[model samples]
Target: MTAIRANSLRNGPDEQGRFGIYGGRFVAETLMPLILDLEKAYRAAQVDPAFQAQVKDLGEHYTGRPSPLYFAERLTAQLGGARVYFKREELNHTGSHKLNNCIGQILLAQRMGKTRIIAETGAGQHGVATATVCARFGLPCTIFMGATDVKRQWPNVLRMKMLGAEVRPVTSGAGTLKDAMNEALRDWVTNVETTYYLIGTAAGPHPYPEMVRNFQSVIGEEIKAQFFEAEGKLPDAVVACVGGGSNAIGTFHAFLDDPSVRLYGAEAGGHGIDVENGHAASMTGGRPGVLHGNRTYLLQDADGQILEGHSISAGLDYPGVGPEHSYLHDTKRVTYVPITDNEALEAFQLCTKLEGIIPALESAHGLAEVIKLAPTMKKDETIVLCLSGRGDKDVESVGRYLGLIE
Candidate 1:
């Protein structure tokens, strides 16, 4: 393996947690001290051997670390070009990469003596993951989900309740991920003394954006090791779907400094990026702005008011993207693209049929981009897509959309 370059792209957020012009703690004054305390606690835990040990142990025994990196033989032949591989995060406990961050944050909460946990989820994978860890640790968890998501992602809502989490459906604005986040932040600010907001993605305030990325970085680390074992070298590319961009940042973190590995992030292009309020492709269709405690690309109007973003996959409809993604786009280190709803739906069926692996609709966005990209590369080249979640939670909604169910 080659050593990381001297001026590595992996080093970021600086001291104030600003990644270039993006990412910073822009929040209400009432929440400042709480954010600071969380930052301090996180820093101390970063070097605490016992804390790190607990995270590692839980990941291995509970969440199932070292998710496989499997070569997609049929997919490669179908593409008729670059070899395709999948980093099977869907096989992890709770069926998504969300569990990786949830496990670490729950441990941190325990260390901080937090008794109540709260979170915001779009696709509901993060909510279920958070609720699962809370049940294991015996802490009360409250999840805020957009009303639309609560209706569409009922399976996950049921799973969270089964794990003992109270699901609060937010109805304001678009009834989507952005509104759910607003409610979560309000709850955090109101109950700052007793509550810990376990953010589900690599976005939000200073410490959260960086902290979540650190926790999820295991995906990329494991991918590199597993790929070396299988192919004896680095992959030519890495791809992932980006909502608030947790999984994308997770798998991209380890490859940021590798000049040879091209990184691609697929955003939800609901209908199309050009269609007003018809897509959630913040990076591709929106511009820089602040929302949910950080500066990033957001879908907004001329007055700078946040606009409702759309996506068939509930998770990828957030109006703003993770701040790190904004920085990556500006630096030209990663290519950000949009995948329309129809394209994603087609890719969803293709993957399930060809691989017998049902992918979350959110994951299908990444696969959709891979379908377009893989065929363009050399046959000797290799590409690994982060299959972020399984499709069980999405089967019902997708079935309705596909006209397979009444």
Candidate 2:
């Protein structure tokens, strides 16, 4: 890996919230005023020292910042290639990296005098995280989940309910994440005065993609410092799973200007990429289109209607990805790979057996890519993988898949 001068990759979305031409406010006219207001408020909050201080304090004491970067000796040895490290975001409170952005947004909601919170979730990690924050703040929370997701990720559904959030099951459009997002948007439009729409990913209109990435960038910031302290330099490569791409973007942002460090995003390949409607490799299989308030690569047909995506990991089953990822794809800054369900499952079991870590199915996609890339690199080189969430919520699903449960 060769070093290069630092670049301005961080100054993204420009003034109109676009990463090149990939992102913009493509919402209904009724929602335009709210989006503009949010952009203004977010820009103000970015420079507010008091607001920054509060978020910092909560990150340290409440959500647990600086998640460890642990060297995976056993797994690295098994792969027999580059040294491997895990950024353990699964250890954060509420059990995933989703809380990082949720906490920041919740604080912003409070500052704006919002009284109600609404969010959409696919795998339930974000929903649970949002519900947890709302419970802590004593605010009413309503979570919209696709009916399919509610059934598949029932554990998280139960967790959200237990946290006092009203779980509304959306039955429209295949009953998945995209549908839930649509329902959340409608709810926000009707209740804009008192409701805050907390999006779970680094996708969505305007300030959302920018703001979520900013909040989640803490992962990359901590990684830069920790890797320097541990290995005395930057990593050779960084890898993470990309659904709507928040965790991957968070882990990749700090290293973007480091030309020597390669980046990889592993998308869920449910069965195989060749099987029709069988995977969620949006960048690989789809084309640019507008959906869910932004223009980006989408899985659509000849008539341009969005198609339902498939992935063993519910989180990655989406038809589109984050706009920044789209920009990165166009510029060749990152390599996006498709890892199939069988591949991810094998990696999941291997990580559990070798490292004693039960990774979420989504994180297993990253591990699968690491397994593929590590064996080709020199032993001295290093790869850092983001362990995005714990597998506790996935154990039952895995058991069912493996026929260990009735």
lDDT of each: 0.94, 0.93
lDDT of 2: 0.93
lDDT of candidate 2 over 75-138, digit per residue (tens) = 9999999999999999999999999999999999988888999999999999999999999999
User: Candidate 1: lDDT of 247?
Assistant: 97
Top model by lDDT, which number?
Answer: 1
For all candidates, what are the clash counts? 0, 0
Provide the global lDDT of candidate 1 against the true structure.
Answer: 0.94
Question: Where is the poorest 10-residue window by lDDT in model 1?
Answer: 1-10
Q: In model 1, where do residues sit more than 4 Å from their true spots?
A: 1-6
lDDT of 1 by residue, 279-344 (tens): 999999999999889999999999999999899999898999889999999999999999999999
What TM-score would each prediction reach against the true structure?
0.98, 0.98
Off by over 4 Å in 2: 1-7
List pairs with backbone clashes in candidate 1: none
